[model samples]
Target: MTGATRTTEHSAADDDVSRRLLESSATLSYDPMTEIDWEAPLPEDGYGLNPEWSTLYGTPLWDEMTEAQRVTLTRHEVCSIMSTGIWFEMILQQMILRDQYVHNPANAEFQFALTEIADECRHSIMFARTCAKLDVPAYFPRKDVVEAARIFKSVAGGEVAYGGTLVAEEVLDVMQRDWMRGENVLDIVRTSSKIHVVEESRHMKFARQEIREHMEGISPLRRRASAALIALGASVIVRSLVNYGVYRAAGLDTRRAVEAAANNPHRRSMMRTACAGLMEFLDEAGLLTRPAVAIYRRVHMI
Candidate 1:
């Protein structure tokens, strides 16, 4: 059999996956606007996320913090993560839009790509509302990081684009599972996380399939380059997940909190645990290059 025949069959399988995913989304997609009670009052003691998921969790700083401070810190940390989610969501939307440009609209793949973008737009709005409801200010990635992503999104190929999307989504999938069920968590945050968990499962599936399809028949040099790019993207995302401003908002010394969080063993363990499946996927796709492993380790996502 010729390579062309193999390619055609592979493409068909991708479309089959896309069609199934599209049907699943149409059947189960949610509107956060109506699903959540935006006007509900938050309890004074409620946390924005599971305390265990906090960056400073299990650290000396965490033990020193009062109960009220713990609540405030987790709330700010969760909001900061939401802010980062919005940032990455916008970038992935642009990347997918470009990937599907001028494609056959009748194809299941194209349709699902658009559907994912629409879902991302909604998720961003959902995150924004949760932040506002909690009275948490917008916490942005660094100016340089934002500018770098602006350029990356505008020009990234479908390979790194989908790989990076998978990284971001996979990291959040595990945490959202905990947040949505966390007792004494804020009602708005819990509802928002529940919505995201259900929808993002589909998005992560789509991204993994897309990356697998894109990786097929690529050259070694190209694979290595894509691996490094994806790893770099992950580092940027992990670093920006909880901005330093969150510490200040929780009324701690920013530098000290940052230092403690950076050295927190529990945080490292959680990050590595969260990324295990993503790393396995990347390895199977021939994208777990040595350089990529090094970068993932640096980010403690190995």
Candidate 2:
């Protein structure tokens, strides 16, 4: 087939996918403001997320903590993750906007891209409100990581942008599926998680579609480089999910808590489980190069 014919076919397929996504959004999108009971009081015994999903869970340090301390620690950890969520959501919004710039707005793909942006805007606000209701202070990634992300959001595109997005969303989706169902977790967190999981599922699907489209006919060297970049992005995100301040907030020694969390076998296992589908997807997309695998292994995400 001629190059123009191939390009037209690809565009048509993308439009079909976007049309379906738009239909899905119109049928079942949410309004977090009304979906969440922002006024409800948090139970003293409630956890911020499922205990099994905690970074320190199953560690000796976790075992040593009192019930109240555990509750506090988990709350801070969840809020920390939510803060990271907000940060990445902003980066993604910028990346999407840039990607769509000068594109045909009449196309379904462009309209759905804007719709996804709208969903992320709502998600960021929902996460911020959830953290405020949990009474936890804002948590940020390291100074260097923050600076690096600023650079990344400015130039990242194609597979790297969508791959990083899919990785983050997939990792969180696995955890939130449990959080939304955790009977011992706070009702506010559960409601918020439910909203996030539902909305982000569609986003993940869209990212996967975008990544596949962008990977077409790319060179091996570029593919490897993109894989490494995406893996690096995932490592930064995973490392920042639970800030060290969370340990101090629970009145534990930061050094010890960090050490324990780093070596916790169960926590590593949880990460591997959470990222199983993501790993498979990356592998299928030819984005799981040797270097990328090493990076994922360092974060226990493989």
Candidate 3:
């Protein structure tokens, strides 16, 4: 087929996907301010997330901790993840805005893109408030990681941008699914996780659609580079999810906690399980290059 015909076909397919996503959003979107009961008192015995999902879970260190210490560590860890969510949401909002710049505002694609951005804005606010309610200190990624993301948010586009977004969303999606169902988890966290899971399901769908669209005509070399870049981004995000400060806040030896977390077999298994679907998707999309797999292995995401 001719180039113009292919372009028209691609545009038509994208419009259909965007239209469905827009309809879905209008049908089921949430306002976290109203949906979450921010004023609810947290139960003293509640975990911030599922204990099995904890980075230190099943380790000897975890066995040595008291119930109160376990609760504190989990709360700090969850807050750290929330802080990282906020950081990446900011990066994604900027990247999406740049990607849609100068595009036809009348198109469904543009409209849905903006809708995703609005969703992310609310998500960040919800996470910030949740952390405050948990009484955990605000956590941030390492300084160099922040600087690298600054460059990424400014220049990354197409499959690289959407792929990274998908990786982050998918990773959190799996964990939040468990969090929302954790009977022992804090009500605030469970409610927030429910809201996030509902909204992020749509965002993940949109990101996957965008990634597929952008990958349609790229060269093999470019695809390889995109794969590596996305893997790098994923590694950074996973590594930063639970800040080292969380250990100190839990009153553990920071060095021991970090080492225990890194070598925790159960935690690595959880990471691998959470990323199974994501790995399948990446492999299908030709983004799971050898280098990308190696990076994913480093983070125990594969």
Best by lDDT: 3
For model 2, residues 1-302, the per-residue Cα lDDT tens digits are 11112232336778888999999999988899999998988889999999998888998888899999999999999999999999999999898888777777889988999999999999999999999999899999999999999989888888898888998899999999999999999998898899888888888988999888888888999899999999999999999999999989999999999999999999999999999999999999999999999999999998
What stretches of model 2 exceed 4 Å from their correct place?
A: 1-10
Question: Candidate 3: where are CA atoms >4 Å away?
Answer: 1-10
lDDT of 2: 0.90
Q: Please state every model's RMSD to the true fold in angstroms.
A: 3.3, 3.1, 3.1
**Model 3: C-alpha RMSD to truth?**
3.1
Clashes by residue pair, model 1:
none
Superposition TM-score, candidate 1 onto the true structure: 0.96
Model 2 residue 72 CA deviation in Å: 0.5
Q: How high is each candidate's TM-score?
A: 0.96, 0.96, 0.96
True-structure RMSD for candidate 2: 3.1
